[model samples]
Target: MEENRGIWVFIEVTDGKVEGVSLELLGAGRKLADKLEVPLAGVLLGHDVRKISAKVIEYGADIVYMADHAVLELYRTEAFMKAVVAMAEKYKPEIFLYGATPNGKDLASAVATDLSTGLTADTTMLDVDPEKRLLEASRPAFGGNIMATILCKKHRPQMATVRPKVMKALEPDASRKGEVIEEEIHLEESEMRTKVLQIVKETTKTANLAEAHVIVAGGKGMGDKNGFMLIHELAKTIGATVGGTRDVVEAGWLPHDQQIGQTGETVTPKIYFAIGISGAIQHVVGMKNSELIIAINKDPDAPIFDVATYGLVGDAFEIVPQLIEKFKELIKEKGGEISYV
Candidate 1:
């Protein structure tokens, strides 16, 4: 236990803003910190990155370790790994948390390997065991039917990557403040392994699953495009967002960002509407962390019912329209707009 130390959260950022999963990790990290009675630290890397550092404290970081460099601005796995490895070597934190984003996972895997520490990826839950000085990393296995807890025993810095929206970000207390641990990278720009010659941002309909309080997702059982559209309409009337299972996304009915499953974006909306979804194990892994789940499928025995707070046996097309209308009425009475349409 003496070899293990404090917690470190990677502040994932893109488009000049910190990613949603980073905040969720902070919230989860804060719990681990309090339980262990140690500091919760955040690590950041990029150019002009100070802008996002303050929010980490507001969310719940006791200290922020920053290494702002031009090479780190864009996610070049090798360079990012170098900076992180250096930090770990300099200041050895017991546990390191990263988001499940492409960049985060790639860098974390490389860092964990180089540092000789174990890493758990796509974890849905995290808890620190004080008696054992262990970090319990929980993630779904065999689809969503089972969950496995991983431990990195006899490791100096245990590392884990968690899904976005799986854990709640603590509400910021503006009055709260924390220390910032500034760091510098001594390597010259020419020493970098990868060079970023040009950058092109993809233009696509990227969904806002992070900002959504309510999300309505349709799966293969939606029957076709029309069935999925009905689910989208319901999401609109409630001012909610629209999502889909991997099948729906593959069908080209929804964008990649709207896909919620083991290989897709993980979401934990306040209210989740699963329409015509068969509740495959992969799909369940992503949204099982949701606060409240409401499932509607014709099959009464669908696996979705296992975790749903509200389960209804009915046709999605028929039920979705009804729910949309009901939501419209409710929102209108209270004066609000449904944006999903």
Candidate 2:
């Protein structure tokens, strides 16, 4: 723990830009680093990623440990893991965080095996003990019924993978100054077991519920597939994206991509409408950071109301149609088009 003194967030870059989750992790890392009075660093690995590395500093990284190599451009598990392990061994950070992204999870699992370190996945909360220098990684346990805080007291670098949108990022400051440590990676193509043939990105509009400004989400209380139409109707009138709970997805009322919960996408929408959701911790962790939360359900004691900024104890079936009509009239008067397709 003495040698491992800094906080490090793995920077995720795609299409020549830093991912939002990585920036958010930097913000979270900044707070932890400040609490521990340690340097906050970002690990940036990619070909010609120095430009992106500088941006990580602007996002609150006090130091950026960068490894730029041809094999690092595309995120193959083998190449990224090798580079990251090399950096971890050399510098030795106290806390290492990665976005719970596909690439991040893959690399973390592989590297954890090699490094013989404990990795807490899908961590929703993080804290550090300045006295003991322990990273308290808290995550949902028992099927999201409770919370668990994991401590890597014996480990050097306590690692965790955090879901996207679960953390907030600081405002970028172009004037922010930081140090850039360029590390050489001696990885070759022959060492890699996988290659990026073609990156097929999902371009569907609803693929990213996390980026939506307004979200209208339903839950099992929605009852049936037909009953869930009210969610879409209301979302259409308000120009908001549609989302559902894990139960709604399991019932085949919506696609898995639209689910908002621990096992699904995490979002921090400006306005979130929780229609018929019972406010489970599993679902709340994904969207508790919403700027405005409005919950409507027949049960007044439903847990969803606990986190809701505004709560209406009424049947969503009865209330949603009225909401849709009202918004439709309002949008018509304002000449604004609905966002729902």
Candidate 3:
């Protein structure tokens, strides 16, 4: 229970490496830490995961509380929840933030239930009330029409789960140091219910849309698969990733990973191309946060132009090919090392 009062981020590790969402949570946690004038801590739970805490330190953690046990090797909903609940019982942190992953949400919900504490889910933003000692968690509600901020006013360890890719991770600073506290995990392997049979990772034969800085995304306006083909050409020429709207993904023009909307992946690429898409509130809410949006649609009355930084009233089939040709020529002339990130 010593030195436990602070903002804490739940660190997620897969195959002994920290997840990007974990680092992103740390970055968000640092802001709350500064606001509260308390240390920003990272809570790492796993079996023999000592090597992971150093990376947490680089991502702006002022302290890391680690719980290593053989029973914690793989994620079990009950075991992890118990371990985390035990940690919470001891330290009593003012604020705790979790990534909105399947495992994260599962563990968080269970822990909140056990502790009889308040918990908010899929928060897009977080802030602290210095006067009330409250954690304000805001998330999109009812198809992104309204944003609701929830409060856990009475809970000692106020908790919220935030969506992935919604927050930015801080640049790693090797010089910025922190503290690591090793804890003894009291769970036995015999008490576990589920066992991990096997782990199969999904393979997509395309660029990681979430990681791409320059994303050329098409929506239903792309018309057909052929329309998406033109999008692919431009994206390939400029070394950008391809993404689509929910309509296109449902139509099988692209995979689910390439989907960029409310039910799909949230993106903030430097340049986003909305080809042939009539911007719906559902779609726009996701990519409206992009740095620069360029919309290409035949309909001048398309709702996409409202949020687009640049609007092109043209057919994507005709325009995308020209854009591809131009980009290839420009890159050929310049040659080598053009990064959109």
Candidate 4:
């Protein structure tokens, strides 16, 4: 373990820009590195990724390990895993963090398997013990009822896959300078199992709840489909996105993509409205990290209020309508057009 030193974050890139989760992990890695008194580094993979190494440094990494190759242009489990594992084996990092995206999970799993090390998945919280040099990775466990902190005691490099939007990225400073080390790995087209034939992006309005500043979410307490319309009405008035609890999705009030809970998308919006939600543990685990949680429910003892900044104990039916009207009036005063009808 003497060879392993710095903390490394996998900088996942898509199209051209670096993924938000990668930057977030860099911010997180910065803190861990400071505590452990080690350098914070970023592992960047893909063709034409040299320029991205600068952005990674600006985001808090002290060093950037870049691998640029034709075969690495697209994300394939085989080519990416080979390059990443090679880098890990050559220049050992004491701690490695990857975003819990589709590609991230696949790559992390394969690398962990090859290295014979522990890899925690979907981690929500992260901390480190400088004394033991243990990377404490915490996540919702037992169906979101309890938080289990995982530690890789016997592993040389502690690895974790953190969910996107769960961590915040540092403000990039272009003035900050760092080192960029170029790495190379041999990859053959025939050896790879999957090929990137075409990249077709979704044309529909994707549910970007993770990035929404304000979200109005409902639950089964919303009664029926028509009752759920009130949620949409308020969301439209405030120019916010509409989300739902697991029960609402099961009831066909919203699609599964719009659900916010342990089994759904985790969100950390600036302001979150929990309308007609009972605040089950599964639901709270997803949105408890929101900057400002405003819960509206008739039950005073509801669990959601435990983490909410403001608790409105009243019927969402009565309060939501009045709230919509107030927002409309406020928008009008600000010279903005808003219609509740």
- Preferred candidate (TM-score higher): 1 or 4: 4
lDDT of 1: 0.85
TM-score of model 3 relative to the true fold?
0.89
What does candidate 1's lDDT look like per residue over 299-341, in tens digits? 9999999989999999876777777778778888876754433
Which residue pairs clash within candidate 2? 279-304
Query: Which stretches of candidate 1 lie above 4 Å from their native place?
Result: 1-4, 143-145, 208-214, 224-229, 232-242, 247-258, 269-271, 289-292, 317-337
Cα error of candidate 2 at position 275, Å: 1.3
Report the C-alpha lDDT of model 3 over 1-341, residue by residue, as the tens digit.
22447998999989998988899999999998898899999999998799988999999999999999888898989788888888888888878889999999998899889888889999988888886777889988998888999997666688899988778899999998888998887898777878889998865533377667888888877778876788888887778888888899999999887788888777788888888889987788778889999999899998999999999998877888888778777887897447764
Where is the poorest 10-residue window by lDDT in model 3? Answer: 202-211
Residue-wise lDDT of candidate 4 within 1-341, one digit each (tens)?
87799999999999988999999999999999999999999999999988888999999999999999989999999999999999999999999999999999999999999999999999989999999899999988888778899999988789999988778899999999899999868988788889999999864322478778889999887899999999999999898889999889988889888999888888888899999999998998789889999999999999888989999998998999999999999998988974332
Return the TM-score for each candidate structure.
0.85, 0.93, 0.89, 0.94
Comparing 1 and 3 on lDDT, the stronger one: 3
lDDT per residue for candidate 2 within 1-341, as digits (tens), equals 57778999999999898989999999999999999999999999999988887799989999999999998889998889989999999888888999999999999899888888889998989888888888899988898898899888787789999978778899999999999999988988887878888988785645658679899999988889998998988877787899999899999999888988777877888899999999888899888999999999999999999999999999887888888888878888877775534
Per-residue lDDT, model 1, residue 293, is: 95
Candidate 4 C-alpha RMSD relative to the actual structure: 2.2
Question: In candidate 1, what residue range of length 10 has the lowest lDDT sum?
Answer: 202-211
Q: Which candidate is the best by lDDT?
A: 4
How many residue pairs clash in each candidate at the backbone level? 1, 1, 1, 0
Please rank every candidate by TM-score, starting with the best. Answer: 4, 2, 3, 1
